[model samples]
Target: MLLVRPPGVYRAQEDTSLLRQVLRRRGRRGLVEGRSVLDIGSGTGALGIEAFRAGAADLTAIDLSRRSVLTSWLNSRLHGIPATVRRGDLFSPVNPHRFDLVLANPPYVPTADRPPSRHRMARCWDAGPDGRVLLDRICAGAPSALDEDGTLLVVQSGIAGEQATLDRCEEAGLVAETVARARIPFGPVLRARVPELRTRGLLGPDQVEEELVVIEARHG
Candidate 1:
């Protein structure tokens, strides 16, 4: 089921596709019941909204974008759900090791150059020079932020070295596993680093592909 944006939210200005897919796959896995959920980098609060709908209690929606914080609040209000939307950099503002379930859809687009929109580049698309910057942080911090047996669900990219991300998680003592994956046509990462991928022997310069990988892992 798709979530309708709250009143005053600009329709068509939000991206809820990934959120829907995550919920669809994990919802059936029975992960959201009575948990204290944290939606990191929550844009428009879609992930947290679905978590709330799926039966999570005590939700927190966090984003770097001021606009997203406002929209998340609006969305929460629309759904009659109570979620705390806080503005911060990654998990910096949040208390450590305190979430039962943490969901992050961070910027996985590996870019050598940043985009014009600061919010888009920082919050939506740029992922360091190799796109693993934010992903690495999540992997590292997830262990501490998550409660014992807590799960960290992230939507990443194949173009961003999915195994490398898994390795990062494993290094952090989290057991990584792929929950779902889909091809996202002409995603921003594909457009940004075909040559770099080829140069690094990761891909052929002429080869262009679009793939999205979603991983659900638990901290040990």
Candidate 2:
């Protein structure tokens, strides 16, 4: 699982690993076999590569950063799998093209910053105030991007409101729920935002850990 992770590009962390585990589980259940897969905000392209190995018939990955797109392409090549990697905002590059599966590990850190930085590194994790900038967009666009029976597996921090994600998907005509969850120690970003998050009522005083959840949304 060696990958070329250039600086300023996101390095796979606990959330990434959790998403990978879910992908593997779904693959084992034959959910990903011969399906078209889309990996949004594809950072290092790890999830797309996993889908390819799991027998995805077609795989496309999109990212907002050129470095991330290059990294994804390189990693796909390293694994001898062909992936269509493009640089653009989420779902913009592949509009009107529906997929059987969509995977995302988007930026979900609640930041006080009004708008997230355009810097390559900061773009990886700085979602605005409530951390739903991209999450909300994904939920809104997922129904249109997915085939009638398609499924979406997206991971986000519980601090960002897991129920909101499920509600958004449901509103979009998908059945959504938390499929997996983990309690992890706050990362550097969350640790630094403790005071602000507490003041915003998003975090409890003395809370040192955060829960991460993998949301599975399926079109009926």
lDDT of 2 by residue, 62-175 (tens): 999989999999999999988899999888899899999999999999887789988747778999999999999999999999998999999999999999999999998999
Per-residue CA lDDT of model 1 for 1-220, tens digit only, reads 3445444332321134665567656667777778899999887677788888787888898877777778888778888888888998778878764888898887766666543236343346667667787888899888888888788888876777889888999999999988777765564546666677678775655666656777878965
User: In every candidate, how many clashes are there?
Assistant: 0, 0
Candidate 2: how large is its RMSD? 0.9
Off by over 4 Å in 1: 1-19, 114-123, 192-202
The C-alpha stretches of model 2 lying farther than 4 A from their native spots are none
Per-candidate TM vs. native?
0.83, 0.98
lDDT, residue 11, candidate 2: 92
Candidates' lDDT values, in order? Answer: 0.74, 0.92
